[model samples]
Target chain A: MNSNGTTLRRIVLAGFVLLVTTGVRADGDASPIYGVRMPEGYRNWQLIAPAQEAAPLNELRAVLGNDIAMKAYRAGTLPFPDGSVLAKLAWKHVQSPEFEPASIPGAATTVQFMVKDSKKYAATGGWGFARFIDGKPADEAQHQTCLACHQARVKDHDLVFTRYAP
Target chain B: MNSNGTTLRRIVLAGFVLLVTTGVRADGDASPIYGVRMPEGYRNWQLIAPAQEAAPLNELRAVLGNDIAMKAYRAGTLPFPDGSVLAKLAWKHVQSPEFEPASIPGAATTVQFMVKDSKKYAATGGWGFARFIDGKPADEAQHQTCLACHQARVKDHDLVFTRYAP
Candidate 1:
């Protein structure tokens, strides 16, 4: 074989090794909607809102969105445009003794994402929901409930609960 | 005066002094919208969005809203409900050499608020806007332009721009 061909074969072998070691795949390729890979730079996205839930789910949540989502929000577009993505980061809510009555974040609980692709997630209201606990994909049972809850509660709003704070 | 009445007067006087020294005032009591006091525990509010502007106006912005605003957002309500307050904190955006391609906050530029009160700010589309630089209210002329800009560009969005990223 030619020297160039040998070099090409080596590059291909190295690429395969890297992929196997990292265990990363394109979003949605690994586990349908439940295991969508976390989007790059999601932490820097636009903030949609913050939330605090009580009782069984005592957590503080922050919702953020990508540029596509922000554009739809600014335009007041409904059903969100394709390519829109949202991330939710939650932490255990705790009281701050120094600043009485003020709540502060304790430990991080989960990081989740809701990706939109009309064609890919058409069966699930054009949105794919995912939750990662400690950076690991949540169980299948937990993922199944995501679609059901959104469909039942916020079907009219494109299966989304957040609105543009604008 | 009786002893009890004298003690009561002293307490009232002390309370007034505390308020003045802290530079805190009830919203709208000071200088129209320019001197509206910063709300307590605002940093804990839900983040509505993050922004980066370039050139003549280089800054990083974080938009946060109180519970009332978050509720309205989740429900997809328009005109945000009464008592929905949003704060925008901005800082000079600077590049961190240690973390290339990442931006870090430098000096804080301003903290601003958009307070909603249909009856109180009826002339300004039910929202009052205020900006403080270095903890001091911006000039009245600069404050006046805030409403005008929002009114002209995002009037349909209740004169606001940030959206909930659910």
Candidate 2:
């Protein structure tokens, strides 16, 4: 099922490339996406780091919304706006980090995303891994490597740790 | 509360720097946080990129599932785990492409997250420029400056993409 999705994605990217290459350019069609007008008060904002001392629980709540994570856990699957294997994979990773059947059934191994923030933008998201199904402790390499995705964020949120300031 | 927390994090970081500079070692008295142990299946867990042909919806789902992006979106604030203001700033840029916040009340700007599949992860989080609030476009400089933080992700997930594989 996952592989099929991958195939589909490849086809779509190919189509987009073709479209961009072969498209007829209207006068207005060439406008840069970056130049699109934004709503009012957008520039008044500056990126401020969330405080580190914020309660982890509050942080978690602000990000995941206590309701969403718990509901997904209870249901055994987390659905997204789009129907894709990536969604299933991310859902499984969050449902159970260990990658056990009981931990996260129907787990896949790929996900992707790009993040945009105020004036600057950053991209991250990555594979979830567990060295053993029932191991006493998850390996450091796996965990740290997972963190490597957000390492650039260290200067921002202290190594990808964000304050769930509500 | 938030300001105080930020101050504490600064102190902790300073102390860590001090310890590292002094070369303070545990001298065999320290224990691993999770009790270090190497596991057998470490090699079995491999990283896989998402399908290149994924549809727009698939890409969107992937972006929405991003742990970092989603957490910030759901919480309606910048959560900084690593205590880096730069990262938080980068996040804001990635979270909202429009440079304005529409979904979040009191928010001054917006951020957008796009998956490797080219799906949009746009959200209106707090903080932004005043011009954006009045509904105008941000300059290219603001959008272009985000590459430094995002560049770090180039090797792992492509410059503009990240993985959320479960």
Candidate 3:
């Protein structure tokens, strides 16, 4: 009985650690949208190296009934010197259930933003116009589609982007 | 001559300060894009606030052209301790040339993700399917006009969204 109890405790501890590490919370606070300023200056910052680990892993996992069709890219906060302003951006992706990455070659949407002094943010740029076709980084004018979609959330902060860090 | 030299020095100093404070550089390397993740002990984190600040901003600025289309908003970051991943989200109200908030709701095109993290992204989602009938966000999903337009950017980021902060 003692041995079993020990095993159960270990499992619980591991799960707690995992949760803490993942930062996977479904509840997010409701903040007014902010505007995105094209990468500006004088703000303290850091860039999260793009994650390639879960990319293919997700694809393979799909076959095992782990086919989570949605994925998101989120940027963290920038503390402006004024201390009153903060900024963030988040992008989400959902694949057509029938489409294959190898065959499709690109995303169907791109969302972005221009967040100003935290109070407001705007969807400044990113491609949000594409269906079956793929988009490339080399394509500039076409990439403007992202801003077109974000045009709806400008009043609050010029931000169509957001922060999940809390 | 002394007066002229002093003026020139002041101008140069102002320019330098602007560059540093704004995070802009003649070489264009200030904007950095970061990824989002969860901290330990969280179940599943998803965006909840600023329901609409998930798109780009610069492009909107160009299209709206000071029309008061939108502004910026509250911003912050989210992080997961284990993976060191962070996600950012913000919100904004996109307006029109009439200087009114976009009457449209939600994104017109689908937000895209790089397939399996292979440096490719596309707008496979239905975010681009809209029509501005009488200057409001109207659903244009029936037109199927978005896909053909997005086909050109297949090589860069796989039609996925990218942040051009430079």
Candidate 4:
């Protein structure tokens, strides 16, 4: 996800997140998926950081890491290993009426991933990307922009925006 | 965790969280562990809610659910099943210079848990509790306070501070 996402980007992400929870698949849209499939059991990963997307998307986000990704984070290794993967789970940010001065997740928005494959995704900083709702991949147009935003902003952090919060 | 914690409580929790990371085991303090050991593979569980502790603790928290716990959450079942388990992972809350108005995880603080087993823990609700650092359990005195705070605050919600945000 873009750290400084444009209004157009947020709008597109908002639409994708909304449609995904409804189980509305774009199966007929035969475009290249960039070979980025949702990782199995991504939900079980440990958190890397917490984020709040500015308005438009207005999502509460948590970035999680696979074991390999976590190891690299703990070791402070630059250029994460090939097996490393990161998952970004997002939800509609809502005020917690039950808890004062706190925000809680409302509806789930998107579950995005960045998979490292030095040999495969070499053209895009060794990371393959995917954005999904209900495990249904977003259109290719969305995938195409992943690296551009990440590279433009946090290319120094191995093309990743999240730091190991813990 | 208390939704409206007192300053004293935050101070105590802060001390415990800070010390745990240093590997300062309280092995000399022989007190009943309440038969609540840290659950295995807890890092792989799905999220329940995100929390931010006030002032003294100044922590970012994410509560996660095991398979049984998640099933009950999604089905809106009251009094979670006997096998259900919840894990609360907390870290020092820090600002992200990389992204504006965003707070990220800093150093890890504590990993706490609530396990539901009505028959075994019928004396003080159906929950068993523990707080740990590097998988080492907190002192028994700390364990004793878990249910008291939770039951006092959120008894209606299965004695849990977290609600399924997604």
Candidate 3, residue A25: Cα displacement in angstroms equals 13
Q: Positional deviation of A1 in candidate 3, in angstroms?
A: 49
Candidate 1 per-residue C-alpha lDDT over A70-117 given as tens digits, one digit per residue, 9 for 90 to 100: 778778788898888988887765654332333445677888888888
True contacts kept of 4: 0.36
* Docking category of candidate 4: acceptable
Candidate 4 lDDT over B1-166, as tens digits, reads: 3645777788889878855642223342222455666654677677777766656787778888888999899899998989888888888777776766666778898888788889988987998787887667777778777777777778899887788764
User: Which candidate gets the maximum TM-score versus the true structure?
Assistant: 4
Interface Cα RMSD per model, in Å? 17.3, 17.9, 15.5, 3.0
Off by over 4 Å in 4: A1-35, A54-57, A67-78, A133-145, B1-41, B44-46, B53-58, B67-77, B131-149
Best by lDDT: 4
| Top-down TM-score ranking | 4, 1, 2, 3
**What TM-score does candidate 3 get on C-alpha atoms?**
0.19
CA error at residue A43 for candidate 2, angstroms: 32
Backbone collision tally, model 2? 72
**Which lDDT value does model 3 have at B97?**
35
- Model 1, stretches more than 4 Å misplaced? A1-35, B1-166
Question: Could you say which candidate leads in DockQ?
Answer: 4
**In angstroms, how far off is B107's CA in candidate 4?**
2.7
- Clashes counted in candidate 3 amount to 150
